[model samples]
Target chain A: MIPNTMKLFVGILRPEKFQLILASGIKYFAPPKNYDDIEIPERQRLRIYDKVPLYPSNLKPPKMQKRLRYMRGPELLHNKLQLKQYGVMATGGGRLRHEHFEMVRLQVARRLDMKRMFAIWRVDPPWQPVTKKGQGQRMGGGKGAIDHYVTPVKAGRIIFEVSGKCEYKEVYDMLRIIAERLPFKAIPVSQDIMEKMAADEKWQEENNLNKYTLKYIIQNNMGGCHRFISKYDHKWYGKYV
Target chain B: MSFIKKGLLQSPVPLMVAKRFRGKINVQKPRKPHFEKQLLIDISKPYYGPPKNSLPEITLCENINKKSYKREIDNPFERILAKECLDWFNTSKMVVFLHVNSISMEDKTPVFAALKKNDMHLRTYGKKIVSMATKGTRYEVINQLFTSHQNIIFGQPENAGKMFKILRKAPQLVVMGGIVEDRLISKNDLVEYSKLPSLDIVRSQLCSVLQSAGSCLVGQLNQNQQMLVSHLEKHIEIQNNPTNSDNLDTNAKSES
Candidate 1:
């Protein structure tokens, strides 16, 4: 059957050249990858996050201080990956506004292959209320009204996690776009990448040639440095504000 | 005189202007530096030396050649598997390490079955098991081949030729390197080794060469004595026939 088709094409191309076409059928195809263990969750897409927390109408909204400590220092609890997959982690501290949350959701939803992959939030939705004065309000006013809400994120905090049958390369671009757009420094990391980063940090600490570390100096109060540094600096060794 | 001039010049100009216009003002002030601050700066300077507890460099590139399958060795099963690997390493005269690329189940089954038929057993041990078994042993050099997916084929040295023949059919299993007769051999050396004659045949050939050398030496040692005996026989013959000796003399002179 192919020879008859080849005869027609002979005027345009040689029949011997078509021999490779027939030979192409004998290719050794690699075995299909096994995804038997991948149990995709019912919700294969990122869940929608609330723009604002539902507060009781009768109660007056509570005002709070700057409480910058919430966004300072490294995240100790949520620093590790729970799902053991790919995610975006903050390298510095900042607030995640409701707009940033929506932006991340939209980007992930648009790029995610929902059939094989699912994304889950690691950080909570916007809950911390940020107050601001009106544009032309007088400075003598007692206090400003609650303007908007934000989620305080700290260094080493994993923003969100993506897991399922997909690989790190598949979700890296989506995570990277989110990381780059965040108000603070952030990076995309997979499980192994995160593990390696931790290992490298441990290795550096173990192999540090300098005998005097920041922790060592603060602990010993060398040169009465405690008088110059803040209490937070004493706690975090000036690693964070 | 300076006080009189100050009182006289207390005229129209303001006190600020008078102070600004003052001439020959003293500019120098006493310096009281903070020695503690200087001490802090001195201590802040980084002094680097070798770490007190220096360890091996952390690296991933060094183990890239071998595809490793890492497994925890704390389990009792892993210990048994490690022991088995040690036994395989010690008992087998030929141990061939192969890098297994992705091969379909159909292809892999046949290749494994063929190897099994030739009395060659193929084993796949995790990197942890291999390290545990090969540590402090001569087979430790082969630990480099445990990087990724590796198959170790164990058999007698004489069956190396058959193993190579069966392995040739499956291109997915690349022959990396192996130990043949307690000696490490590369891929090319393995091929050469497989082509070599069997041990019995080589032993017979060596015996034949030795026997031939002995016979040649015996022949060489008897050559001068045999020539001398032939000359004595010729002299006896010459005495027995003097008339014949004269004719023989003329022939011997011509021959000489």
Candidate 2:
């Protein structure tokens, strides 16, 4: 079985994963506003959702003397709180200073269950906060200037590509649980499990009874959400009757 | 229990710290006044030190070299030291966190002095004149930390690890701590620290001989199972250095 990132991410965030994410930080993901269907290559799909390694990315990938040597059945699902936090903090055109990253470093490291885990960021120029209140009731009105940053990145969308080969089903269950429970709503639907959920009549009824009701469900969970309805495309798996 | 032991002995830095004060540190490092208690001792009415309190040297006098010279003991010093530490804090206090890992030269004497009087005040807060023990382990100090905090880190690695074992079984307990890496240290590292023959292992041995090691972990379960188990790590870090949390929000492209 040639393993892949999609399989890995699906396997970790099962229901039992809720407690970890609750403490770790919470936020799922939103589809990229400028998501391109054709451009994303096969290898880069992992980056689209999320992926963390047990070993340092910078370290040279060691040659496998024995395929068994590389076969540690390691797997992880991050703290839900962490995913949400990252979704809110990273998705928007916000730039996190170095130390802000460390606050959650311990949890992130533990999730990967590896020695070292690090991340770098590149932010697009964000919009300047409006100093003056908008006339009457405007979008960026009153309340201290609604600081907006513009980025090609999309916040509120969580996509994790977990790896390893133990209890992949549990991981999938965790992703579903984390997605629903996170503070920020990441479409409250999993691209990873859409196929399965679409096939499962019971799950579809529990999650998407009606076209508009499901929208409300996602919104109620995440409050004022914009689903990447387009991400699933014409072949939307969990399309309600 | 076995895991905790493995974690402790496997601590990143092995070997207990027995030295002290690398002289003063640069202002940049953690020169927090809290880390410099010896200064507090000196500035306040001569709490502890030499001249009159030296350990009796090997009895040079031939006549005195005989019999059980247990009377040369500075037993009173340790009692006085514990009283002073409690008094120094003013009002009552609990869980004296002596970093048994780090102690200084001047620090060693007080620990010995404290140990003599059965005092467990000093602990290593990173190699200095902070503290040490008679047998050279702050096991007693750790036992106290556990007694006071209970569900917090107990003295040994097994005790610490037991928390997670219990927590794994009862997730409602709300595990929390200083957030080492991301896992709460209270339940995380302390559990890891519980194992690995620490000063506690030696101290427990002594306590056993004295038939006095207290019952472990039973009283430590979380009655506050429903109450939020919060460790001050994240809130403190955010408050002191908002940027230190490593908040990565680069993907947020501003609404164009």
Candidate 3:
């Protein structure tokens, strides 16, 4: 039989009352809600334009004289490094509009899980602002109000890089579809293809074909007379011409 | 009357017992809180140390007749550059050399920037190839080249082909080497190289071949078991039906 004093003590310290005190203490000291638990607002997802936009007319596009001619050619230097497993290169040169870029972005994003796999834009979207006069207005008195801005793409420019937890073969057709939608002649190229092309070019020149080839003459259109004297030919002899 | 008297007596005793217990029990005393001094550690300071050497000492030969030269890569940074080249060469099955002649610095800037950006992207996927302007002596010794022209080397055979396609577009840069299959190939050979499928495609093709072979063996092994099971079922059917066995005996007798 239990002592009368002990029985009285046990009766005072009931399990239910002790548990209630512990719960209240824990409620007071529990860590604040985790940062990751905070819910993002729906309004933040909406697109918002910048407060002030720059005028495209005010800025000057770099004079790309020599570079412009090579735009339609294979990308020579830029994007030479195989930064991604799969990439889309613009084979044909033309102006790329904002809508076109957005469409391509949406198409790629829809196909690829944007979380595991993502794309890096090689070309910048047109940020220059172009204002226009009313449609019925007559021809320009001063410079006509600027039309919409555009990004001028030369051939051989890499459009975008797709990478991360994605296989090249799986994304090949998807990328091809995106390339078809692009205004310029765009093609899907992997790191291997690019490297092979570079190697072939190097091999040709090493054998002296690049220095004295009929293809060079036909491509450059230096008729038979100027075939020997290329524009790159240096005048080793003193200028006694 | 006795039951009512017992209940009334018990209730009064409990009340007196509770009063007596309250007097005997001592309440718990509150503890004084103790504060500890906090130690603040600074982690923002950057650590500095001597540069690490990354390049391995190896002899790269240019041709059969030509003697192999030992390249002098003295600086730690130079070793890093050499190491990058070596890494690309060893990892890639194909390596390419290019001679960029007469392009002005202004024009080269954008090209360099693009190459650098692409390099960063490639590094992420472990397909990155290094492209650095050849410092005549240093690069030539390492790459086993004879040209004095401004050159660039793209390493990693898997990616070397793609770089080849892009390089082909630049009519100005002359390709100097196409190393593969343990021998140097001529310009015409590059066209053949370009026609080949990428490494991933080849790997997938090989995997499919192996998978088909495995599946064929599994099917062959399963064929005998299936035949045996069917034979056993036919035998059991004959044993179960006496009329079918008698019909079979009559057919055999008629044939004879």
Q: Best candidate per lDDT, number?
A: 1
Query: On residues A46-164, what C-alpha lDDT tens digit does candidate 3 reach at each position?
Result: 13222233548977533222222223333445554345467888766655667777777777766875544556677766644345667788877655454665565655678777765
Provide a comma-separated list of chain B TM-scores, one per candidate: 0.61, 0.16, 0.37
Q: Each prediction's TM-score against the native?
A: 0.48, 0.16, 0.31
DockQ of each: 0.07, 0.00, 0.01
Model 1 clash pairs are: B66-B147, B66-B148, B67-B147, B67-B148, B68-B147, B68-B148
Backbone clash total for model 1 is: 6
Residue-level lDDT for B228 in candidate 2: 36
Q: Please give, for residues B102-164, the per-residue lDDT of candidate 1 as tens digits.
A: 777799888889989988998877676798889999888888877644689999988888988
Give the per-residue lDDT digits (tens) of candidate 1, residues A1-241.
5687787777558655654311111223445566668788988766777877888999877877766768878899999988888999999888999889888889988999988888899988888888899998889777788888889988899999998887888899999999999888899999999999989888877766767777788799886787766566578775565
lDDT (Cα, 0-100) at A197 in candidate 3: 67
Q: After best superposition, candidate 3 residue B99: deviation in angstroms?
A: 64
- State the lDDT at B39 in candidate 2: 32
Candidates in descending TM-score order: 1, 3, 2
Docking outcome class, model 1: incorrect
lDDT at residue B153 of model 3 (Cα atoms)? 46
lDDT of 1 at A108: 89
lDDT of 1 at A7: 73
List runs of model 2 lying over 4 Å from the truth: A1-106, A115-156, A164-182, A186-192, A201-241, B1-256
| lDDT digits (tens) for residues B163-231 of candidate 3 | 655555455656766656445675567656767788789899999999999999999999999999999
Per-residue lDDT of model 2, residues B126-242, tens digit only: 111112221243222333332121122222222333434443433323434422222234544554554546566779888886663244333345434423345455566567875
